[model samples]
Target chain A: MVEIIVCFKHVVDESELKVDRANNKINFEGAKTKISDDDKNAIEEAVRLKEKNGGTVIGLCLGKADARKSVKEALAMGCDKARLLSDPAFQDGDAIRTAYVLSQAIKRIGKYDIIITATGTTDVYSGIVGPALAEFLEIPQATFVSKVALAGDKVTLDRLMEEGVETVECDLPLLIAVAREINQPRFPTLIQIMSAGKKEVVEWKASDLGIEASTVGKNGSLVQVTSTQVPKSARKKILFEGSASESSERLADALLKEGVVN
Target chain B: MRFLVYSEDIDVELELVSAALKSQGSQVSIALVGDEDPKENSKTLSVAGVSSIFQIQDPALKDFLAEPVTSALEQISLEAKPDFVLIGATKRGKEVAPKLAVRLKLGCITDAQNLRFEDGHATADRVVWGGNATSTVSSKSGAVITIAPKANERAAGSSQPDVRVLNFETKTRSSKVVGKKAKDSAEVDIKNAQAVVSAGRGFKKKEDLILLNDLAGILHAAIGASRPLTSDLGWMPESRQVGLSGSTVKPKLYVAVGISGQIQHLTGMRDSKLIVAINNDKNAPIFQECDYGVVGDLYQVVPALTKALRAKTGR
Candidate 1:
């Protein structure tokens, strides 16, 4: 039986993300937590792949336990099993450490045919973890996947490219990181929600995974962020008080005055 | 203390990162991750005075996919153990750097405009919220820093990748590299271009961009615009927009036309070598910041400037 492990992160809401102008730190104060949009798409993709091809879907949630709920969301989405990896040490971790913990979890979960993930989290908008995990797992990966199908042991898929889309065939047990063009995300059903609620959330810590602290979290990190504050935004609201045509003309006039239209 | 400026085997990126780090007095090293032969990548990194270049080449790395690329870094970091690792804030770097940092258990500053090390620690200038604010952030612990794409303005100079080969057994999974797709930029590309001609909302419509493009073609410059040009109006893609929400650009000559120089937009193009502004409003922020200012209507003035430049440069 083919087993697939999906890595996902719960990030701050992108629509509500705020920056404190006093300092350049992103404001999570007004922001609520959300599954990284890409990860969410990945979760949906994994579920669809499993439902169609018949495989076990394992959800790997590696972040603060607060993100444990995120795994429940995954279980609701169709994951057979979910693991929540959280420790105080893992808080505010950079992407590398997060991937490390996830890798350890994957290692522990052993014997997987595929690992599926989303391209990136919307907040930081960093799309690094997918390929990083593929390398860590020693597997080949395709990014920006659109259409995917499995025949026998090989899978055929399409990638959206600059010039033209290309089709490639790869053996199974590969990694896939989805870009924005994948299928629209699926909404959970009543049955899925109920199942997810009952689904197990396996918890693991750094010690549980036998990952050395010196190489696994902030202590092992090489770069240090000395400060995080929001940037100061220009608060001026230039309202052209006039009709659309008037507004357009006035705006044009303003642009000329500013030397922007000249 | 040294800085490892990581890049995908791109020529322009190699030069920009090395130049920026070297100017900052950090012994810069490069880890060019790709399927290409390591020798060439190493040569590209070395010309900029990079002490050494590390390349992890496997058939798995060709597409610049995030997973394998990031894992390679884990091995590189453990071995090189540089004080700080920098990645360009491009699409690939955006995906890979954070994951690489997570796996390596390192701190990272993404889209940072500036970097400074004191007492062997990294201080970074990270602009967030469309450059509405500037946050001077330093990781209390180790970090994996990502320089915002096109945000660095340093000129590319003599550099070669001082090559080293680190064969890492990448642990990859289900993901596969189907193919790569590049986005078309409506404005001029400033990623590594020598000169740029950019406009803000003041241009009003896509119809006004012809003169901008014409001038750019004559000047051998790339065209760019404020975020609204691409992000909201859909005239251009986000990849070409210059602002906090869009791509950041650094060029030798940045011509701001009909641009009011909002902070968010300016943050992306503020690092240009020479800035010239042509706007009707003398009070626009761009006027104060630009090296030269011309007050006029772009519709008429741009064509005139284009002709004048054509004659001056004999293009």
Candidate 2:
């Protein structure tokens, strides 16, 4: 049977992300942590595919030890096994280092056919991990995948490409990053929750993983934090507070002046 | 000097980026993350003067899904350190970049069209409110910065660097991906095309597209549309849209049939080799920027244009 691993993260909730000017650090106090919305989709996709293919679904989470609470949710979601690599040292981990740590664990786990992930995370929504991880694994990758089904030796997928849907066929042991459109994420049933409670969650650390500090967290990261702000979009709404005919006429005129409606 | 770097990596695309720290006299190492084949893509990037290729190749790295991608990117950033990171200013990139910045204690510059290195740090130039005001922002935090990826040409030549593998561990949380469906479209991709014919909300109805297709067929160009033309009336998928919240196009020849070139929309196709605007209004914003403008009703002008093209090419 194939082994499929889904990497998940517990980050500061979006509504609570704030910048502390005094220290230039993110205030994590009282900040509720939850699995990233995009990561949830990744976990769910892995669970669904595992169920269909009869493969093992393993969940890997990185962050503080407190993140285990979030890891439990992955177990409840249908992951057969869950592993948490939480350490005080890995708390402020960056992407490149995170990839290295996770890749080593996957190699230790051994024997996998397919891996899936969500399009992006609510925090650090760089949307680069899917391709980066695929490159790390040295496998052919397909991004923006919305639909997937196992067809004999290859996985048939519908890629949410630019204009039209791409019906792609790739061999197994491949990487596919899923968009929100790819699957309707499923909630773990109560029975699954009870079973998950009994399931084991393995733990690892920076030293336990045999990683160097220069390549793990802050020092290992290639990019740094610049600034954060709400997307300030100024909408000069030409509110046509008139009848539809008047609005349509004004819109048409706007189009004509803008050269749209000729 | 300040360098506006573009990296699709999740973790490191922040505001307080300091690439100059590594190389005393070079631009910040930021550019689009292309294919992950190190020997092929990395060699190409090396020739372009990029210091490193922050590659994330987890087994799950295929699609550009937002959430998990954000999570994994956090992993990559923790590994390969760069000055500033930029993502494509598409829908997913816009949503993901700002959110990702927050996780890594970073900031973001939205919808940046161009990037340059300045002073002793990197400052990004982005339009504040759409196209109303252009602002140049500098970050003392030296945090990883995220900007909309520009149509940056790939640096010619190549260098092969060590391909570092990153594997991050995480908990499996419950979220369901139960169904999958694709937004259907019948048009060609505006980015990869050589020439394009686009429409805007001015077309009025679906039936008006016949004239557009005829003209496009004669010109040997594919069809595209502004955001409203496809989103409001559902004439096409969001992917075919050319404007803010859509794909950026730098085609050779772009024909605007019924489009009133709003700045948000114009930014997507502004780099076209030649722009032809067809609008009844001679003073339309599109006319100002277009290489050629025809002031006439599309009902008559379209057929005439098609006939002229057909006669000239004898197709």
If scored against the real structure, what TM-score would every candidate get?
Answer: 0.67, 0.52
DockQ of prediction 2: 0.03
Chain A, candidate 2, TM-score of 0.81
Q: Tens-digit lDDT track for model 1 on B207-299?
A: 768768777886677777776676557776556667644556677667788888866577677777667777777667666466565666667
- Interface DockQ per candidate: 0.18, 0.03
Q: Provide fnat values for all models in the order shown.
A: 0.31, 0.02
lDDT of 1 at B233: 76
Top DockQ: which candidate number? 1
What residue runs in model 1 are displaced by over 4 Å at the alpha carbon?
A: A17-31, A156-169, A212-220, A224-226, A234-237, B1-11, B14-24, B29-85, B93-109, B127-144, B154-315
**Superposed model 2: Cα runs more than 4 Å off:** A11-34, A149-158, A163-172, A234-262, B1-114, B118-185, B189-315
Query: Native-vs-model 1 lDDT?
Result: 0.67
lDDT of 2 by residue, A66-175 (tens): 88888898999988888888766664455545666776666666777777766666555445555445545655556677678886667777765544466666777777
Per-residue lDDT, model 2, residue A19, is 39
Candidate 1 TM-score to native: 0.67
